[model samples]
Target: MNYEKRGGGSRSLPARVGRRLWVTAATALVLTAAVYTLSVRTVTGQRWENAVLAGRRQDETLAAARDANHMLDHVTVSSLGAAVAMLMLIGLARRRPALTAVAVGTVGIPLLLAEVLKRYVLSRPELVDAPARLSGNSFPSGHTTIAMSVLFGLALVVPYRLRGIAVGVCALWAISVGAYTVAAGWHRPSDTIGADLLVLAVACALAGLLARTGRVRPATERPSPLSALFLAPLCLVTLGGLGGGSLLLLESVVRLSPADPAVPRLAYAGGHALAAGASAAVTVVLLASLHRIDLDDPAASP
Candidate 1:
């Protein structure tokens, strides 16, 4: 969470860029807020709403979205985005006091749009049962937009040496919002992706305008050792077989007739456990090597 300054001088080239990004976020906040407020009008006859409910899986999709709803457990990314914005504001307090001014100036639009959208749009899945706290047009997902406004917006403040990583982090966070929204059945793929792009466009425009200048850095990554390991046919078949075998076992259990009492209920727990382990192992290894900030570590020097 901390970075050792790469070089020291009177706000070197990189520092200047960071300053500019903060400035851009400040200004863009106001403009995007204005646009969000002006753009959230409702359509007649529920055209978009009807389209989302189309298909045989319509009832199932609506049900899944309802099932996916949880108070705070699943309502994530929204808070994460706010926390990140708060941190940026705190960090930029001193040298970039103007950044604070910008944050203050434009905090109203996203909030206002979220509320307006909630009231104007009338197709929330939960509302189908009966109106609850969350209802209205979900044309643009709130969680997805927050992800863009905060993470993608912060990309400008990221050091050029680390901008790529910053952008990837932002993307991952944005994608997570898509997963949450779609899994919750609160938004269609079209809704979430569209919201994500609009947010990114606004963020980029603001970040770019404030950017005094830009520079490109080269990537010099070495291939990981595990590529050869995973490339083996045995490894591929083992991984695939484990996954398929686990699903087949589960399917067999699910399809068994209720009258057939002889079918062992938990026989494939062992197979399922094995498949889970294989998946976890692969994820753990990939995540462990994603980055190596050790080059900047004081002890890493010869």
Candidate 2:
């Protein structure tokens, strides 16, 4: 059942695919959350919107300035941000070998599971108030889920030296996205919360598995102090935000660049596929390289 293929010389290709699956899950979760909220609003009638929606709850921030146009925000908010933390922990796992196992296992297994759940269970997003441009099913917030997984996944592996800061940053990013989604009228507040919880559950289960693998201590015994200070949580969020922001900027640049109307469709799709593939490839490489840094260069160890 362990889909995690052991690395022979370095990380196996399965590992790379498995890692990419993690980001895919994260990306898919946001779309899925959007879809789920629409369905919930249609059927359930005001699940989270009527109650917990902080943005709509009191936001009143809609102005002529227009909402922020953030597409790859999910990449930074969910994957890039958590990825750095998860990878950082993986690096630390060398000293805490058990944690290293947890990091890889958590990042690997549930990633696959999240995808299957998205395709079969969720409905696509479509509503009058919802963003017209979006096209995908949503049950759980893929973005929220991925964000939680990366941050919480770290809780399973980080040394006592860095647990508080790790969790704090993770929570901040997820919360910001959740708030923005509600404010942007993209999803009901409850849907986002549910997705966040789902990711936490997935992450915790993965952590437990790693513990069973003798990678880290048990949850009850894992004395992770609640160090999520207001300012402290802001630490790694910039990394993800910047990555996503940069990609968006590149997209703008691409749009401004000279176009090829000769073969528009193929080039457009190819360009997108290339970008997605590249973003995903870089994410995996960065994650794996971060993990292997100490092993590849001993002096780098803390």
Candidate 3:
């Protein structure tokens, strides 16, 4: 397989990479702000999210709650340590220390940022007369952050050839975790969306750093088409089906009066579907952005 450099003539590789990175990071930041504003700072947003929480008892079965709890139980400090260790092992095995460091940063930075934003920087004001359970600030959920950061970290470190397979498998877990956060009433749909976007912004920034440092290169071999063929349609279908379904569900909620008996159930279902769709969209974005680039061997770089 032949790998070609990305630029020609006056345009430099680093320049191109940096431009793309800035654009993506800016977009993620704007989206994060939008999620916070629309979902946490607005009355309508608060009403719907609170309604979702209220409906959890009706929609979430005992077994389903248990399953969500069991899934969340896996997101402990020990598991994060193990995940970091595994990512480090991959970098060590490949003899790419820079890649390893970036991979670790990709995981650690978002987790820390999510905590800071949820705890200190951002706040959920008393925008609506909500229950005590729904009063606190829970944007950029820690559990969803952990799941997404780990998935993005794994995607960052895996070999180019295996990138699609690795992301495809891990995306399912990440997507499920995001949805489970809502299903368990631990987070709102926007919380999961915020986490996904935070991870994406950090990942893009780090990839840009790698490119600027000359630690990124074009792939030497073509990625397996089968992975794309399989994963692309899967993501598209998920995005379209769940996204469309959630819109319809939420549209009904919007049209109905707040006192209607069906509002809670509709909002809850819509929020759940929205959470899953957001995760799927994030996975697709990360895969598309990363599939073409390979981490350069540090020793081989000039």
Task: Please report the candidate that would top lDDT against the real structure.
Answer: 3
lDDT of 1 by residue, 75-175 (tens): 45567557556736653743343333333222324434554654674233431331232234565567655544555444434333454454444444444
Query: Compared with the true structure, what per-residue lDDT tens digits does model 2 show for residues 1-302?
Result: 12133343222432343344355445545644553454354532222122222223233344611442262254554455467565665667556554565565555444455566667765443332433333334444555445455654564455544555564555555455544554454544334445554554445444333323333211222323455353232433334433453454344334432243322222222222222232232223222322311112121122
TM-score result, candidate 3:
0.92
lDDT of each: 0.39, 0.42, 0.81
Off by over 4 Å in 3: 1-11, 297-302
Cα lDDT tens digits, model 3, 11-92, are: 2555566567767878999999998998899988888888888878788788999999999988899999999999999988
* Candidate 1 wrongly placed segments (more than 4 Å): 1-82, 89-94, 98-111, 117-136, 211-302
Q: What is the lDDT of residue 246 in candidate 3?
A: 73
> What are the clashing pairs of model 2?
29-141, 29-142, 30-142, 30-143, 32-138, 32-139, 36-138, 98-215, 124-137
- Better structure of 1 and 2 per lDDT: 2
* Candidate maximizing TM-score: 3
